[model samples]
Target chain A: MAAAFTAIGGKWKLTLLYWLAHGESHFAGLRRRGAPITPKVLAEQLRELEADGLVERVVTGPVPARVIYRLTPYGATVLPVVEGVRVWGEAHLQRTDGQSVSDTAMSCASSIV
Target chain B: MAAAFTAIGGKWKLTLLYWLAHGESHFAGLRRRGAPITPKVLAEQLRELEADGLVERVVTGPVPARVIYRLTPYGATVLPVVEGVRVWGEAHLQRTDGQSVSDTAMSCASSIV
Candidate 1:
């Protein structure tokens, strides 16, 4: 369980993977998705994901290279867990609607997932 | 997604819930389970879980005050996500056997889960 968390445990890693699942994206594109993750942290998370073999970083072009990230085959294996969390999060939001939700919860609820 | 993470996203919260699922335990009993979590942290995690309504804390005695923790019916709803992470962790360990795994991964893999 720790291994799974180690790979995707960061607050934004799974969210990053979820975005990648929809389609590949450059770092800038990901940053624009609005999770409030700093560039340093985002780079770090993506690097760790790559090292864990769950995400691949592709650099294209000689000048002004575009670095794209996507899930690896091994990384794809974790989609079920990510999807599970997403589904549960959606349910939880409805379940607790009108209840006070923290900024972290609100940000992660609609945008992060 | 963030809501779910906010509820049970602590390093040891889900594991604590998993242990509680098997049976209720006091703070000391949980500390003995061997996760290396400090008393302060364990207490805080349980408190958060309690506040989230996923865990129920019962005071069983007055003089000694045995505090027992267990999963509420709502707490049980998260078992599937926890189980999914566990299964993925187990598979990840097998998939990467003989490969380098960090201390965090090893600790969370066998003992924490």
Candidate 2:
């Protein structure tokens, strides 16, 4: 329960999954994508993802030691799950203010400002 | 996708879901459950859930106006998805450190401390 949810629930983690789900990318390449996290955080997230078996790490050791990451078959399974979330988001996109869920209601009820 | 993900992704959201999945509760009643949040935050979350149609709010007027919230049929759909996450979490519970996901991996690899 916690694992899979945590897998998708990581801050900037979902975005990483969204990107990796597109295809594999090396560390620098991912950083260039302008992820909303620092390189240290990014690398940390990727490594953890790898250990959890949700991602595959390929290290090409020749000189600079290139390390690339991709989602595993299990990670791919989250597509439908992620898709489920995406569907929900799309349907409520306007009302959700792109934040997904009903944050709007709380925004209305509570003055978090 | 974003909507559903965000819905389930809210802090204390899943915990709320777990509680609602079992039964309904009101503002003060829920507070006594030892939720790891403030009364203000709980009411805010519930109101947001109500607006999202995931929760039905019952307001009884007389004095302070008691408002009790319960999950709606639409909100019920999230059960399977949350269950999916739960299954994933339980499967990896020990390794997950109760924080859910593989946060431990990052702890091991990156040492957030």
Candidate 3:
């Protein structure tokens, strides 16, 4: 549980996981998908997730050095928990317009009370 | 959901909440239940939890200065999620002997992979 929490609890980690779960994604794809995220932060978080073993990094080719981030078995185990959190988040995470989940990360739990 | 996650995702927050779920408790009660927890760390965590609004602080007497921590309504909302995490943790958190959960906090999600 702690691994799962730590894996998904970083600044851009949850958003990164959310994107990767859909399918394999390159770092650029994620950068395009999420605004307010710089390429450096994206790469840094991907490395952290990969090193933590939550994300699998695969090199696709030698010519272009294409890399893809995929969810590993460990990452799969926490997807359900993440889904639960997402469902719960959508319900209460909209208090301040349609802000991103990370922006309101601390609000969802506090609002229920 | 983010609120729920953050609320329960602290270092000793989940364990503290689990004990509190059973009933209101003084600081000493929690320290006794969980071994290797210093009185100072316990007090610090309790104060943090209280500040987060997950635990309610009450002063009971004028003479002896009794204080008990209770779960707030916000805290109650996240208990289900915590229970889910605990159940998940118990299933996967026992690879390294019967050491305390604090020692194995990062192992639970990692093992699932």
| Candidate closest to the true structure, highest DockQ | 1
Across the candidates, what are chain A's individual TM-scores? 0.80, 0.70, 0.74
> Candidate 2, residues B41-112: lDDT per residue as tens digits?
788877777777788887776545377777888788766666655555455545545553334422111111
The most accurate candidate by lDDT is 1
Q: Each candidate's TM vs. the true structure?
A: 0.75, 0.58, 0.55
Q: Highest TM-score among the candidates is held by which one?
A: 1
* All candidates: DockQ: 0.38, 0.19, 0.19
Lowest summed lDDT across 10 adjacent residues in model 3 chain A is found at A104-113
TM-score quality measure for candidate 2: 0.58
If ranked by lDDT, best first, what sequence of candidates would result? 1, 3, 2
lDDT of 1 at B42: 83
CAPRI-wise, candidate 3 is incorrect
lDDT of 1: 0.70
Least lDDT summed over 10 consecutive residues: which range in candidate 2 chain A? A104-113
What DockQ does candidate 1 have relative to the true complex?
Answer: 0.38
Real contacts recovered, all predictions = 0.35, 0.27, 0.18
Give the least accurate 10-residue stretch of model 2 chain B, judged by summed lDDT. Answer: B104-113
| C-alpha lDDT score of every prediction, in listed order | 0.70, 0.59, 0.60
Candidate 1: tens digits of C-alpha lDDT, residues B18-99: 6776778887778776566788878998998888788999989864547788889888898788777767766776677733
